[model samples]
Target: MFKKSVLLYLLLAIGLVLAACGQSDQGSEDKSKEEETTQGNEEEKASEESGSESEEANDKEEDADFVAAYKEGKDELAKAGEGEEVDYQKVIDLYNNQLQPLVAERDGNIDQQISTALEAGKNGEMDGQVVKQIFDKLTQKVFYLTIKHEFQEIDENWGKKEEVNEEIAEAKEYYEVLKETVEKRDAAYETNMVDQIDAGFSEIEKAVENDDNLGFQLGKQVVDKTLMKTFYLAAGAVPNGYATKAAKEAEEDPDKAKVEQAEGWAFYQSISEYITKYAEEDAKIIEKNFNLETDVKELDPEAVNHAFVRGLSKVALHEYEESEEYWGEDKSAITALEGALFIDMIASDIKRMQGEDAYNTLNEQAQTYLDAVKSDEKEKAMEVLEKIEGTLNSIIEKAK
Candidate 1:
């Protein structure tokens, strides 16, 4: 009887141990699956967080009310060309009904210009083709300025992720409308500006995602300054600018040169405010020389070109000055990048004025300074920045 009881207890103990072991194995499998699921979820989240210009554009809401109205007006005007009999009354009605209200809400100046252009076209005071060009270019300017306004809104609404994201989307949409002009300049100058601008937009989206205000500011400068550079190239940059074209044509065909000068003047309006902010006198000279009211034969492309170089050099120097003041911080890095971009705006002219070797040296020094700023190497950054400043001062004097 004692042996029987002992054997029975031993058999019950073995059964309990086997059941526990089976549960342990099942729990281990469950844990392994949970870890794999967590890792996969993290990876998927990372993939969604990555952004691009196209992605931002895709995320944007459909065109705004003004955008639709502007497009409709543009289409209506497109039918009016050189020597083509246009329904002037129809264009007037379209502007009054569709564009005028939106322009008034957006910008009073734009409203006046559109109204003036429409009246001039209706009265036969301006050529139909000229009127159309004015209409399109002026509207494009409004779009560009709206982008700036959107950035300001983003800054104001910082930390409100939804509002900030919406503003960014709006800005991206406006940029898309202006992209053709960027592409045209890139093709003409053989520069990769479109890529630069796209990278800037990407930086902006990433900054927004990370909730980094300084990063957003830095990205904004990249996009803003690059677009400014585009307009500068259109207006007065060497080798292929309207100023150069106008000068070349002036001697052979004054009328055609006038048209080119007018184009330069129109494009210059985009960057004139920035130039004026830094170098008022230089801005005045540029504006006067490129003024449509000024005869093409009287326009001095050389003087206009020189003024642009001087003004931009001053602007670059100011950026470096700000970088110096904000040393050892992200602002320093931001201004350093701005200084480099401003220098790059006149790179072709720099290469022409200072030999290629000299321009290369300057570029290398600028890049070194930027790196030092980013790394928080105050002394090294200051040393390189001073050298860059001195070189720019010399360039400014020569430009005079």
Candidate 2:
């Protein structure tokens, strides 16, 4: 009986061991399957993200290509307008070799149409009307680019406060007008206006070269005025033949000539109001900020010129009296004070030789001018202006 009981115990132990092995194998296989599934899902998600990034990149590339093509076309058109012969074949080659491939990827028809136009133009099969149409299309493209470029330029430079605040404001105003003019460009006047703008840009470049802020401001003003004239022309505010008529009338009638002269002066006054109003403020800022002892040689000629012109204009218009409002109870107006300060700063050595009394006399004369203008005494103001001019010239001569 004891031997039979031991055999039963051994059989039960063996059966339990086999069951445990089966369960271990099953768990291992299930875990392997889950890992494979998880890996596959992760790979799919990564691939999808990569595809989205690629698509976005391609879209941006296409936009850049479009802008480049438009700029190229407009540049070519501008060259033609300048009497340069248009190389239609070269343009066609560029389109086919570079631009068309980009368009092809997107299934666009623009490249094909442009190719056809260039071929037609090259073969001399296109009529004047067709040529005009092509040029017009190109000009329109240029207009868009001009607006974009100008706005970008302004935004980039707007933060640079190396210039006076008033000058910066004027530049912003001019840029705004230019943007609007480009947006609403009349087809008939496009070439003329663009030419004017280009000329103004040249002047601005010159101003930059000379380090003259006032010149830059005036150049930009010219561009603004040109754009305004173009706008007015398109709106028929000025008569179609007004220029010729005005010219002839000036030649024929003295009275008509005087009227036109007065009209011109009125226009000048209207446009220069801002300059007149801010001249004193600018001078005050300069006075407060600039250290004449250290910065005398480095003084901005443009600022000095701006102040000089403001004073000259006021005197010419018999509006010197109005400038007193800017002075309040101050002994001297801003321009006179600025001029005297400039002399003191630039000619300190000469001032030392001439004694303090001479300098005091100069200040007194400037004060006298301010008093004369405040009292509406034109004759006295004129006399003071002449004396001031002579004294300033003498000081400048001595400094040299």
Candidate 3:
């Protein structure tokens, strides 16, 4: 009976071992399957990323090819000259050959349409030139459409165009009137009596207000006329000797640039006032733009030019301080500096050779001017230094 008990015990131990082995095998199999799943997911992600990269590369190549082909077509057309048409199909065929790989990569979608257009052109079965013209027209249409949308996007952009139009109109309509008014009676202007000017001085009043978009058409014409006047004014302001010389050669030889700058300022100023007056809805755009300019300071006793020029002026005035903030050390900032430190060094040398008094005076004036610029007290600083400068100028003239 004891022998039988021992054998049963042994058999039970064997059964337990077999069951444990089965569980171990199952766990191992599960681990292997999990590892395979992770590897598969990683492989799929990599494949997708690589495919996307390949697609982007192909797209870039396709765009470049298209540009090249378009340029080539243009060159060929130019060679064909005026009143002559080139073989559109021939150009299309050439472009298709260059685009084969790009189309194949895109699963032959856009490429297929291009191929069809080219083949049809080749056969001369259609006005092949029409196809090229269609594409050219589309390109121009796209550009103009983009500009139209841009004008919509920024209210300021639209205002600029509108302001330009308004100025042009005003100059053409009222410029002659003001001039004629002054011409009729120069005494009022000479005596600073601008308020006592006549309303009726120049240009014939229309007999009748015609229908058929007269206002719209007149608006455009007025803008164009204003544009011509503004052009003359701007041309006067250009410091180019060529422009100045050309003006001097003209019958009414005037400094075009100064005239133009003055006229532009007047025109823009009037437009600004008009916009502030009648264009309440549109003026909001100008206000938004005005707010966006970080450096623009609205000085109460100044005109727009002084106000407009100040934004850049202030930044320039504070550049040295701003630069210190941008770079903790001078190494980076020093590399991008754009002026002549040598000029200051030369001036220092001159002062040393002359005397302490000359150097002291130069340093004092420079320091005062720099301090004034920093303090935004330019006008006061100028008043203080004007006599000093005049004295120095006279002294130098006597020495010369």
Candidate 4:
């Protein structure tokens, strides 16, 4: 009986050991499968990320190519305006080959304009200079508005640092194309517009680095208003602007004056929305005065000119009001700077009408208000702000 019991115990122990070995093998196989799945998922994710990066790079390259093509087309057309013999067939072919596809992609009224202008050029129906102005200035308007659109995207994606930074970069790229236009205006007008715009862009960069939304907002306003100032200089800022040029040439050379008027209208469209925001009636009047479709002989250059002054003056007043409302805060400084920028937009006109000394005094007071707001000196800011408002109001009244 004892021998039989020992045999039974040995068999049971053997059975338990075999079961343990089976369970250990199963666990090991399961772990291997899990690790394989994890590796596969990581590889897939990496592939997707790489694809996305490749797409972004391709899109950027495409835009760069498009800008080059645009420049080539514009330059070719401008040569005709400069009295250089241009092969119309060559320009048409260039447009069809390079510009048409891209312009079609951005299809709008602008596409129609481009097509019509090119057709006219091909058929010898439009002057080359007019074609050049249309292409150059209209393309510029698109870039300016694109910069605005990018800023709106930045605002929408404010907390997403990478996304916001990307939008800012795009905005800067658009502005880069516009910098030449600003520089040209500066050369003609003897203004420090390029420096002002550069400072605004620098502020934008610094604000982004620090993740200060308000600073970014303020910086955007400066860049925006300064660009508006540049457009104003091109369109209506007296002595040298298209508005004045058109008026002076009207009696002597109606055709040339009409071209100048067209140029003024094209340039004004770039900043019309901003002006319309502050003074809709004035915007309408200005538009009517510059519109080529209107009776060119009956066009009132003075009305267009004064409307711009009134519109900008109203914008300044509105900004100062905003500054006053946001007192004791960063917003005050932002709007104050904007107000000052608008005033500076018409600085030459201000000096002309109010005299250089008065203009200087107003400029000084504006700087004081901006500084006071930044330093949190509410009393001083308010005092200077009131004076600024008074001056702006007087200017608006006179513009009427």
Q: TM-score for every candidate vs. truth? A: 0.78, 0.27, 0.22, 0.79
What do the candidate models score in CA lDDT, each in turn?
A: 0.75, 0.41, 0.32, 0.74
By TM-score, the best candidate is 4
Deviation from native of the Cα of residue 11 in model 2, angstroms: 99
Clashing pairs in 3: 168-226, 233-260, 236-256, 236-257, 237-256, 237-257, 237-258
Q: Give candidate 1 misplaced runs (Cα > 4 Å).
A: 1-65, 75-81, 101-106, 251-255
**TM-score of candidate 3 versus the correct structure, residues matched by position:** 0.22
Candidate 2 per-residue lDDT, tens place, 242-289, comes to 122233354466334322322222122212222334344533332221
**Per-prediction CA RMSD (Å):** 24.5, 32.3, 34.2, 23.5
Q: Quote the lDDT for 35 in model 3.
A: 34
Query: Candidate 4: how many backbone clashes?
Result: 0
Whole-model lDDT for model 2 versus the true structure? 0.41
Candidate scoring better on lDDT of 2 and 4: 4
Q: For candidate 4, what's the RMSD?
A: 23.5
Give the higher-TM-score candidate: 3 or 4.
4
TM-score of candidate 2 relative to the true fold: 0.27
